[model samples]
Target: MIREFDRWAYDNRLRAWRAEWKLIVAFVMLAVVMMGGWREQWLVLIGMAYWIVARARVPFSVYGKAMLAASVFLGLSLLTLVVSVSVPFQITFIDSQLQPAAKLAVRSLAAWSCLFFLLITTPAPDLIAVLRRMRLPAALVELCFLMYRFIFLLEQAAAELMLALRARSGGTHWRHGGMLMYQLWMKTWQSYEAFSRSLAARGGVASAGHTHQREKAHVPLVDVAAGIIMALLLGWAWRKG
Candidate 1:
């Protein structure tokens, strides 16, 4: 996925420019302002603006999914809060409780945006290289690789389970709900058992790669400048806040 984003970014000429540094600075300043108890609605506005400008140069599809996922989660969380509080707290729509929700949302958005930007833009292999360069243990890196591979397998298994359920249940109408759920549980268990058995047969250490060759790439000047500016902005935000 990271490789796909790299290809897309390069294809679209969405490489970093000098103005991106200014946007990063502005985001940091807004984050500080947000920490000073800005109105929830205002904070949300600023947070979104920060995300938009910060992600502007990246391939839209790469970052758009992150934004959409965050929005969905935020909406669901806000809805749950509103429903739970409507009686005791006398809250109405989302706007009535916007301040608290906005506070939570903005902080989450900031942290997620920071991490997502770093991950989507940075090559996965380069990340490993940097970690190795910093003397991280080989065992940990191997664990990371294994975990990444397993996650995709797990996701595929989950999709198959969902499809099987959908085929048998036909939208899980009330008449078939209980039976459908039972079938799903049985199928899920069988899937897990199969996966565990496969893992055990593989000596519980699948994909044991030998002779790892570390690929080398020259770090560009722009990447260095971007890192420095981001670090300074982060430091300033921390101290000023």
Candidate 2:
């Protein structure tokens, strides 16, 4: 899970500065090359995968599992791009459609890999701190903070509820699943209401602001130079594409 990744990231030497630079540089190149050709996208994907597996030292199993989950959703969404329906509801693949779908799939995979690299190498708190330093909107940052905090809380609550249900039912069933889902929703809503009241009690939403000032991070000059090189490469790829 993400919590395990966070712990691993903090224990590793590549936690803050290197991870932040890689995150920014990788995504910038990804965005630029994503607008280019499939060749460029594939290049970006390979570079990112190498950095993640070799440089960042993320385990292949972790990367594979994450990509597999993403591919499932990406494949489903891409079905519309590749498949067309005829008058008789016959599904057909047009030759022209294949190119666009391939381009999209490559670009998407590159983007997802870049994102996963950042997620596995940087903890949420450090990432939020970086975002704050980058002058992101306070409200948006705060929303993300709350969402991150509550996701674990909600997951724990759901797990406990499911365990109780299983103890009573002896096994899972459609009816049990439905009951568990309903209870989870109700619990989530109640928790949100309580949080809202608590926030209200402490003046207003504006008072919920928490300053995230950490020790100044020192990004290596080499990384900055590399980022510049990547930008130039992306420009060339764009023109070539």
Candidate 3:
């Protein structure tokens, strides 16, 4: 899935548009995503889906898979906020936690969708280039690139672990799931250590092309107009509500 996003990022319909343009749109919508209530959140989510799926020409299935993968993590994190997930698995939810949990869930999903828009349309290195152009700290920018690289490493490790567990063919016990995660953690660390060793030997910097080259990319006027209109409507809805 990570590969899919990166692949599409380079090949998407929005590739010709300025990466800065996409960044601005995503960041501005984040303001509305954070400040506005559920109504604004829903509107932003729909609008982003249209941009990513329809306008950007990303397959709906790929978007759906990404959302489902994201939702698992989101749901578990939110679950812990409202319900205690300790030993014995008590299904307890405080009355006060429910409302805030719902709000947080809505906010997080909208935010993730905005990020997906960016990830699917802009290459990872290009984004790093954008950050460097903005004068972001070099250390922070390098960290971002390493993290982006690890997503692929982690995915490969997870795929192998799943296959191994399936071959073992045990009962559907909770411990099996835990063991899979534990093995995955160990495998990932080993791979990371090997990567570090080889990188140290080479003395070459990671692939974050330090040259922040600018391209004369075109920004579509109609798309800009649509974004402005959507932002205005979301703002109006937030204020009126």
Candidate 4:
């Protein structure tokens, strides 16, 4: 999933557009979501969905799967928020929690949709570049990069290990399944070590006595300018509200 996310990010139609505007559009809509009610949130949500699916030309399956992955957490959170009691075999939903939970669910989904659009369209390295251009702290930027790379690396390792197990026809065997976990742990450590070495060789981290160069992309004008303006207006209204 992480690899697919990175793949789409690098290969999406919006990949070449100026990362600045993408961030602007995403953050502005996020502002709208942060302050806007259900109506405003809905607008942002649907608009972002369309931009990602229709305008950006992302495959519907990819988008759905990505959102569905995020939805698992959101669902669990909403479940906990709505369910007041789980002990004594009394898993009861509290009536009083329904409205608040619904509101939270909407807000959370809106926020995730907005952010997901950004993630899908902009590659992680580009985002890190933008953060550096914004003059954010080196430590924070480097940490974010490492965390992002680490997730991708872990996913890659797990996928490879699972594939190996499956190829050997032991993927479903109980003994092999248990060993898979151990293999994955060892693979993760090895992948991390390899990643560290490669990153050091590339001088990926600025703190490692290496000068990290920043390559800026031209923020080309996009057709979404009008949409961005509209979103900013909505953000203004949200401020008043």
Candidate 5:
């Protein structure tokens, strides 16, 4: 069932929508980065949150995990700052730093959440197709394609290595964990080496030739409207803030 839903989500129309929306989202994030203000950061957080929840339909369970982790780090940092407070430590500057850091955590979570959605909803083939359509250099597209393809191969290799290690059933605990760690590291290295050789042998052509592919994308009216709306919203956010 999950696989079916994922397949539907990666359909051409949805893939195009995700690609366009993500580009807009990235632009908003870039603006926030340049402005370097807490207000702009908050806007990025909101934009990312909307993209994840509304478009991606990420479960609250997953979001909760990220929120908890961020909260723990932020809380610890704040506590440390408060406990280390001194007369020489300017309170205003400390507070100012704290504001940006907190906003950064929120924005990072939001952006990651959107990326997670993309990974879940989009298939690798369709994503590469979209990038090709966007005029990304052929070399970059091929590299991106190979990286994604090999990640799963590497993960499976790691998993099998772990199972083999466990099957040994020798006295393996934290003290002997180093052996397993070394084995896993070597497996990953070798897997990547082999993957690289395969990629080279294939002439780094990860996908079918773009010969039959469209030379340009047909940007839908909905995409144009969304762009206008996002621009207005961002402008308002900047002025109001």
Candidate 6:
């Protein structure tokens, strides 16, 4: 389901004009604004959401799921900020600490939304291409590409394994779940080893010349100009703050 949205994002009309570097710069600028104050952070979050949904045409359901996952993690971490243990060893709610907790939550939400917008609008391969253009280490880019590919492969393998187990056992028990997890890890490692051997047989890692093709997509100058403007504004705001 997530991959479907990713594919859509990659093939979207915007991909032809949107530059990966511009998106990265915009995310950074929004992140700086998020750090300024909760009100500004919330506004940034809303604006990012709007751009993603309205301009990018990403489905709200897809965006909501991604936000929910990040929210869960942020909520868990904020609990530590809001709850305290004193010398008496009793956990107490700290009223004053709520302000910091709220600030952190809003900032985190804004940051996550910025990243999620990037992920949904840009494909991993395009991002790797941008890194190569930036002269990032070739080995590091290849490593990132392989890791991204393997993540999807592993997820598909796990889903198939779980479905087969459920079909045979009528549902998974705690013991069965543990055993299934063990099998999944073993299978993943086995696949990785086989893949490594195959790569070695092909004369190890291929050179960038043989692997990645240069991107031909036209990057919009307007977007780049807009990003520069936003960055300048963010810098001025940071200096004032």
Q: Distance from true position, residue 192, model 3, in Å?
A: 3.0
Worst 10 residues of 1 by lDDT: 11-20
Query: Taking the tens digit of each residue's C-alpha lDDT, what string does model 3 give over 1-241?
Result: 7788788998788888777888988988888899888999989988899899988899999899988888889888887778765588667777789998888888888999999999898887778888877999888999998898788888988888888887888537788889988998898889888988988898967555444335557767867787788878897888878
Worst 10 residues of 6 by lDDT: 207-216
| Candidate 5, lDDT over the whole model | 0.60
Q: How many clashes in each structure?
A: 0, 0, 0, 1, 0, 0
Most accurate candidate by lDDT: 3
Of the candidates numbered 1 and 6, which has the greater lDDT value? 6
In the range 179-226, model 6's lDDT, one tens digit per residue, is 778989999999999988988898885654324334456656755564
Q: Which residue runs does candidate 4 get wrong by more than 4 Å? A: 167-169, 173-179, 193-225, 232-241
Q: Model 5 misses residue 56 by how many Å?
A: 2.8
How far residue 41's Cα lies from its native spot in candidate 2, in Å, is 0.9
Candidate 5 local Cα displacement, residue 241, angstroms: 2.9
TM-score of each: 0.54, 0.79, 0.79, 0.79, 0.62, 0.81
Q: Candidate 2 clashing pairs? A: none
lDDT of all the models against the reference? 0.55, 0.73, 0.84, 0.79, 0.60, 0.73
lDDT of 5 by residue, 1-241 (tens): 2333344455434354555555545655665645645565566566555544554555545555655766677677666543445688753445546665666566655555445556544566666877887899988987787676666666677667668777876536775577766877888888778867987998875464432222235556755676577567767777877
Off by over 4 Å in 3: 80-99, 164-179, 203-216
User: How well is each residue in 50-145 modelled by candidate 2, as lDDT tens digits?
Assistant: 656765677777778788888999999988988898999798987888888877887888888877767776777777777777899988888888
Q: Which runs of model 2 end up more than 4 angstroms from their true locations?
A: 16-20, 84-96, 202-240
Order of quality (lDDT) = 3, 4, 2, 6, 5, 1
Which portions of model 6 miss their true places by more than 4 Å? 84-91, 208-241
| Candidate with best TM-score | 6
lDDT of 1 by residue, 1-241 (tens): 5345545433322234222343354456455545544343244444434433454455456667776788788878777655545456674565566677766776666555655544444444445555555688888876776565555555565566557767876656675556555665676578669877988987786344533223334445655675566556555545554
